[model samples]
Target: MAHKLTRLVPVFAVDDIERLCAFYEKSLGFVQDFRYGEPTYYVGLVKDVVEIHLISTSSPNARQPWGSGYLSLLVDQVDDLYRRLKGFDAEIVVLPDEGITAYAIL
Candidate 1:
């Protein structure tokens, strides 16, 4: 028997979990599944999939260096998604082009 890799959910160290959650919800359209007090921790779902878990970086253990990891998402229309995210207060870490995709650090 062989085991197969199924899914991967990236956890982000965010300074403000609520802000991060709002960014994902407004910018990326991910829905909130659950959250803790002070909105320090939260789980978001997209298309019924648990795509991201936002955790507060106030704790010493939660803080980590930015640009230390990468998250790859497969979507039906990348251009449409990019357009939708344009209104949000997010930094364009990378812009999409031939053979490359855009990246935003929100």
Candidate 2:
């Protein structure tokens, strides 16, 4: 017998869990699904079919290096999302016409 895999969730190690959650909610429109730990050591967010998890980290060095830990999201309206992110003052690493890729830090 073979085991079947279910959903896949990407976890981001962030220095500030609350900030990351707020960013996803405010910038990307992802809703907060759940949060764990008294100090919020873990969080889950969902938007459409995509789900993202975040974990609080005390050490910044524990986080992935710059340009790494990238997550690719597929949206219904690429242009609309691009504009929303830009409107939020997000860092647009790649232009929409050039294959949309954005990174924002709060």
For candidate 2, give the lDDT of residue 80: 73
Candidate 1 Cα lDDT to native = 0.69
Best TM-score goes to which candidate? 2
- Tens digits of per-residue lDDT for model 2, 1-106: 9989899998888888887888899998899999887767888999998999888886433465477667888657777777787788887775644563443333
Give the lDDT of residue 17 in candidate 1: 73
- Candidate 1's C-alpha runs over 4 A off are 1-6, 42-45, 60-67, 99-106
Off by over 4 Å in 2: 59-67, 98-106
Give the TM-score of each candidate.
Answer: 0.72, 0.79
Separately for all candidates shown, the number of backbone clashes (residues 3 or more apart, or on different chains) is 0, 0
The TM-score obtained by model 1 is: 0.72
